[model samples]
Target: MFTQDSKRALTAAALILATLTCGCAFESSPRGELGADQDLLKTCDPAAPPASFVQIDGTGSSNSDAIAAERMTAVEAIARRTAVCSGYLRVTVFSSSSAATAVLFDGALKMDGATENARLKRVPEAVSDVMNKVRSAYAPAVQALPQSGSDITAQLRLAAEWKQQLGGNYCLDLTVFSDGFQNIGVDLGARALSRQEAERLAEQPAVPKLAGASVVVAGLGRVAEGAPPSAVVEGLVSYYTKLCQRTEASSCTAVSDYATATR
Candidate 1:
């Protein structure tokens, strides 16, 4: 038993402690991590020419035709038109089974240097070739989802590794084409993850951190042969948002309809 005044004081102290604890948690939370470092966002080169590194998920999908067409458009657009880079601009593609060599050059084919123009001219052609390679990486049939599912976490790790190699020397614009159904390589403690669980899991250390990058994720809602449930679509948007924030990407967006994604 306690006197009234003492009890009030104790309660107040407890409330203060709880408030402080909650604030600490939010400050350290994965969602807020990227915003914490305002400097990293500011450090990105505003003048840097846009560069695209596209990774196509080779996991089987039902609406692959739409996904492929939209994805190829983005690739061709980026390859054919990009600002001249005094330093080499890197354009590359990755699929579950294969990866294309980076087309590196200083400027576009229209640039004055013959060597630079020649290298730049090859990028679009190389991207076309890589698109074919990515198509082959997809499953042969809708029912033929691999025994192993899409390893999106692994792919994210790879992207982070690439960013590290790039070493903040240039701003990165990354694009990922996937159905947003991440499975197989993810560890959910031997069981499936509920939406809430999956979203929480994305904040954990298993996900890599990226800084000074902008990421766009396309082909989210559509699945192999049909569309995903609305709930799943919403969940993926949340999941990608959380994951991107953890990476410290300056921006992140998950678009279901690719036709309008660029807009």
Candidate 2:
């Protein structure tokens, strides 16, 4: 038997507790938080918007002698920053001899708002893990792959295929770390394309099937043994740019430095 005033106070306390519990549950619910996170990502620049699928192409330029630490760091940043929660990252290293691609990080990464810093910090470590695996296991297993030289078109096609298999709404980000000299599977015959020839060829339509995904072509100007000349790099950039344009990519550009490009 409680006094009326005492009962009223208890009722008020109950209501307050219920309200707080509901609020906390909403904030912690996976669906509720995902919606909130997506809203935050919308504020990002359209050019640098969050990604649904990020594919890293590690070919001759990325794994071989041309592998530049600076460029790799930049690429790692792009892959990490663009990766949104519930997205996927696929890293592939290919040579004429063999190829290997793996999902380095998969699932929701919580790319909204304050999580950006955490995501950024996570990217470098993720890249290191992937690269370590590449150097140790992937490279060794594929050592006998029989070097056919660099076959870039095939790599892009593979990336597109992997993205398509996801089978849903996704913003694709394709980052190619390469020296931009593709010869093995190119139609120009066994000989690499000269800068002049590459320019003329780049004018032709070479659209990828990644739908509306954007592309970032970095490390395009590196030179290595059997790599394309510096002039060829310029032509390759133009070629990829045209390809991206024809495919209606969100954005596409060849960056000299990954760090500078992202900034």
lDDT of 1 at 151: 61
Residue-wise C-alpha lDDT for candidate 2, range 171-229, written one tens digit per residue: 56676655555535344333445656765765564446655666666555554445454
Residue 58 in candidate 1, Cα distance off native in Å: 0.9
Which candidate has the highest lDDT of all? 1
lDDT, candidate 2, at 34: 40
Give model 2 RMSD, 1 decimal: 17.9
What lDDT does the true structure give each of the candidates? 0.49, 0.48
Question: 44, model 2: CA deviation in Å?
Answer: 4.9
Can you tell me which runs of candidate 2 are displaced by over 4 Å?
1-68, 83-86, 97-138, 141-144, 185-199, 203-206, 225-230, 256-263
**Cα-based TM-score, every candidate:** 0.58, 0.58
lDDT value, candidate 1, whole model: 0.49
